[model samples]
Target chain A: MSSGKHYAKGSPKPVLPDDGQLRLFSMRFCPYAHRAHLVLKAKKVPHHTVYINLSEKPEWLVDVSPLLKVPALQLSAEKGQPSLIESLIIAEYLDEKYPQNPLLPKDPLKKAQEKILLERFSGVSSAFYKIFLQSSGLDDFSLALDIFEQELAKRGTPFFGGDKPGYVDYMIWPWLERLPLVEFALKDYKFDAKRFAKIAKLIELLKADDVVKSFYVTPEQHIEFWKSRRAGNANYDLLA
Target chain B: MSSGKHYAKGSPKPVLPDDGQLRLFSMRFCPYAHRAHLVLKAKKVPHHTVYINLSEKPEWLVDVSPLLKVPALQLSAEKGQPSLIESLIIAEYLDEKYPQNPLLPKDPLKKAQEKILLERFSGVSSAFYKIFLQSSGLDDFSLALDIFEQELAKRGTPFFGGDKPGYVDYMIWPWLERLPLVEFALKDYKFDAKRFAKIAKLIELLKADDVVKSFYVTPEQHIEFWKSRRAGNANYDLLA
Candidate 1:
């Protein structure tokens, strides 16, 4: 029973390992896992990344993560007692356990707002993905992108939480990375990149950051992978 | 900001209403609002419930809630101040502000587990609702329901948090109430009510409780509202 305030003010510094022992079981393609990667990079937290093959999931990985989801964290040498699934929760846990560079704001209201943004992003992204997968037409997809643009515009900053990237930014930025591919897919529908100028600018800013740039992949590779999947290439490794 | 623990040990008295006057702007039929209702009922907290017409949302309601979603909770009398939106966050806020009955377990691992259940339930319910709306074939619907049944069986208890209902229960139970209608919609799917005996027992137990029973509406009314929506009768209030 960890009995203390939710936000421990003036607590002793958290002891982190000198050796790189934090193993992150993640797939590069999963938006959820990408959230954890972005946060780790932003915080400068040293961790070994273990890319899992979703199809023939390793027995050891399956034993640790019952759900077999990507972005499972294993701290130290503990195998069975690994801190398991959920990207947001894992990011939050890391932020709490190692609190030097805070991902969440101190104000309760601000924290609540961060949560709302995360929820809204999750909802909007799900809808966007559904429309993208089900309908080849870009009408609904454009509307979704427009909504994202509007949301970013309202923030009036490069990131969701104004100034420095926080929890919301970590969760949202990975999904935004796939936008180039989405635009490529719907090129015939007059999908203008300028329509999401604010978002594109923000993405550029994120990619420019030394820490944020650590997770960047070429947009072409992402599109090629999806195209392969669409062509019945079941053997393709989604984790790449 | 009112700051003090909401509940004390032993007596189990409800926290007095906030000095700013807490008012809940919600629709009766919304599962999200029912989350707030459950927390209030469990804690014996009092608040005014304003039922808003979904078809013609009032300007005041829209002003308070930009998303215009039901289950928004106003902590203070001031109209323009940001109110808590989203069911899980509202429930957590209530639990944090007024610590009666301890809706969440204090341990971090257990708390994580609770969140996983909430996330799983959210995913399953959203998928089920979509399938239900599309009136997909029984085989497809059954596959979805099978997943739900499997998840529930894993719980090994009626309530989400082993024997006792907690945050996850408040988060999920409202959606579960529509199961009868869901069953009716997929009547030809060999829907086995017996497979969900645990859920059935839990529902009966919840209904037996005065607090839970207060939120119940007849299945006929629920079905009528759902059917009306399908028939393009947009004027009918689904939340009522």
Candidate 2:
């Protein structure tokens, strides 16, 4: 479950070895890819990662990823390393394949609830893209954030899944982890921390992973990454 | 397990029974809702359905579906008939609850493959919306359809999950069912049957369900419903 070592973006993808190891294809700052990293970390699944340059994608990625997106899990099977794309499906795949520390609840209904939460959180990502790309629609996102806060109040659970941070938490946290960067870019824009107490607390717990040694990027770096992408020339080597 | 009865569109919703019974909230012509109807049929789940007037959404639906969309499943339990919304989530809930005749493949990797297939098919829906709404861009949709056909060919499976139709087949079948309707709206547009032979076969299997007595509406009816909606006065009672 150790944080996957960073493979320099634009580096050639390593050969699909017969060693039978689960490999993840991702970019350092992509939240969708981060979802896979969080699930792998939470489940303590031993795996490796190959960072892809979105601007200059490797041809090999398409062989595995039908859509050529990251967070594609290349399973180490005797038959061959078949790749699985889409973070939600990959997360579910990890949960099902490695049953030792389950990310989803044991109860079917509760598990369904976790998935619904993931669906509900889609608005936040949409808001993020709209704000970052078009530089509009911040207020619309706040409505979704408010609903999320209300849901937390209604549940009265420390995390979405009672005491533990289940799939929903990990699924949502990847984006929330980068919200600070959004705030930095969009001045005078911030979450009402007091109103979103649970979220604020969750962010705090998520902050420990921001240390330089940690697997994921820090909020400060994310802001720079956004600035680079906005210029139409993404600086993938900012942290290199 | 039995097929759910369809409610007349535009009719008032039936009283929610206190007795436990799975009820589906849907619109007869809605392809998204049709996804759930197909799953319920495949699983043979004995559920009731309330056809909603999407144009005139009921207040009660908002209580269950935050987005006020249909394909919401209300599960009768001792506590209450808790409702689940969104076609995919509700479909998963149904699959999880009714273990018999599983919609998804049993193997984790196979299950992941099915989900990725569903995700890949999403472009078809988006392309459908773009072409239908903007009244242009048929070629792009054909490319997506081409990928889908190629996928079925590559796998050499009767269905996306192999053999009998499963979740992927049901989830995607709804949109493909409407492609012909789109073709009706836009001339010189048709799925290449020879290219998509597997899909042509699936359509043959799907047509029997298109009989007047089936719970869902036929593709011909879908074209009429779409025409009605386009004119800004939907004829929900077209089938009636």
Instruction: Name the top DockQ candidate.
Output: 2
| Worst 10 contiguous positions by lDDT, candidate 2 chain A | A1-10
Q: After superposition, how far is residue B217 of candidate 2 from its true place, in Å?
A: 3.5
Q: How close is candidate 2 to the true structure, as a TM-score?
A: 0.91
Alpha-carbon lDDT of model 2: 0.75
The TM-score obtained by chain A of candidate 2 when compared with the true chain A? 0.89
Tens digit of per-residue lDDT, candidate 2, span A158-191:
7675676767777888778788866875787777
Quote the lDDT for B50 in model 2. Answer: 75
**DockQ, candidate no. 1:** 0.30
- Give model 1's share of reference contacts: 0.21
lDDT leader: 2
DockQ of prediction 2:
0.78
Kindly list the per-residue Cα lDDT of model 1 for residues B1-240, writing each as its tens digit: 112121112323233455666666666666788788888877777675666556566655655577888788876644455788988887877776676777888665567667765776655576557656875644544554455566668767777656667787667778767766776676655436686666667677667767677677667766776777667764234433
* Model 1 Cα lDDT, one tens digit per residue, A41-149: 7777777666665655666565556777888876655434555579988877677666677888755556766787677665557755764576454565556667668
Off by over 4 Å in 1: A1-22, A44-46, A55-61, A74-83, A122-142, A146-153, A188-197, A230-240, B1-19, B75-79, B123-158, B182-194, B218-240
Tens-place lDDT digits, model 2, residues B1-240? 312334433445567655577877777778888888888887887777777777777666666566777878877772555677778888887887789889887788887887877777777888898888887767778777888788878888777667766687778877877777778767767767887787887767656543212655566788888889999987766765
